[model samples]
Target: MDTILGVSKLSSKFQVTIPKDVREILKVSPGDRIVFIHEEGKIIIKKA
Candidate 1:
């Protein structure tokens, strides 16, 4: 369950691709909703 993916590139639209390990860790799939919140200077990412 451990893997790493490097950033390929960023498109002109400001969209960045999520690494495979991160995606799996977050249990994110296509069309899945994710929420980002800021707490105590840290970013919290959660699945919605």
Candidate 2:
């Protein structure tokens, strides 16, 4: 598996942009949906 690294910054509207490397590793393209899960105080992003 490939590891992508990038810092996350929150916009004024509270929206975040996923790092390009991470998106590519996950093979995510435009219009694809993702799921955000919270467990034990950790957030996980997964393809939907």
Whose TM-score is greatest here?
2
Task: For residues 1-48, write the lDDT of model 1, one tens digit per residue.
Answer: 833455547889977777787788899999999898999997666888
lDDT of each: 0.78, 0.86
TM for every model, in the order presented, reads 0.65, 0.77
Worst 10 residues of 2 by lDDT: 1-10
Model 1 worst lDDT window (10 residues): 1-10
Give a tens-digit lDDT track for model 2, residues 1-48. 845488889999998888998898778988999999998897888989
Please list the residue runs of candidate 1 whose C-alpha ends up more than 4 Å from where it truly belongs after superposition. Answer: 1-10
C-alpha lDDT of candidate 2 relative to the true structure: 0.86
| Whole-model alpha-carbon lDDT for candidate 1 | 0.78
